[model samples]
Target: MARTNPLQFVQQVRSEVGKVSWPTRREVMLTTVMVFIMASLTAVFFALVDMAIRGGLRGVLSLFG
Candidate 1:
């Protein structure tokens, strides 16, 4: 394989970095908020499901006892 000098490696890294289209501050904030909202909704959904299952199990045990 061919090897690059230190200077050439630096230049190549800078060139690649310049090609990146970084997200705007507003876009980043919006995406972060969306992720948090989705995560919270998922947590709530699972909490409700867990509560339902727990209640069903308790009721069944009470009937047997």
Candidate 2:
């Protein structure tokens, strides 16, 4: 069996990195914008649901007071 050398490990890492297919800048920007839009939509939906629940609970408590 061949022993592993430290310098050979660095060269191996560089070679593997060179073969990776990275995303383009436009693709990254599009993905980021999509993520933001989805997040904002979810936040608005949850906020409305939370407000409805709070209002209902407030009304129920007021009846018992």
Candidate 3:
């Protein structure tokens, strides 16, 4: 493979970085909020599921004991 010099590498890096479409501040904030909301919902859903399983196990065990 061919190797580039340090200066060429830096130029290439800048060129690639310039081609990127950065997100606006509002877009970032909206996505961040959405992520937090989804995460909270997921956590609550799992917590409820865990409680149900735990309650079921306790009830079954109580019957045998």
lDDT of 2 by residue, 1-65 (tens): 88779999899999999999999999999999999999999999999999999999999999999
lDDT of 3 by residue, 1-65 (tens): 99999999999999999999999999999999999999999999999999999999999999999
**Which residue runs does candidate 2 get wrong by more than 4 Å?**
1-3
Model 3 / residue 58 / CA error / Å: 0.7
Supply candidate 1's per-residue lDDT for 28: 100
Best-fitting candidate, measured by TM-score?
3
2 versus 3: better lDDT goes to: 3
Candidate 1 per-residue C-alpha lDDT over 1-65 given as tens digits, one digit per residue, 9 for 90 to 100: 99999999999999999999999999999999999999999999999999999999999999999
lDDT of 2: 0.98
For residue 56, what is the lDDT in candidate 1?
Answer: 100
Clashes of each: 0, 0, 0
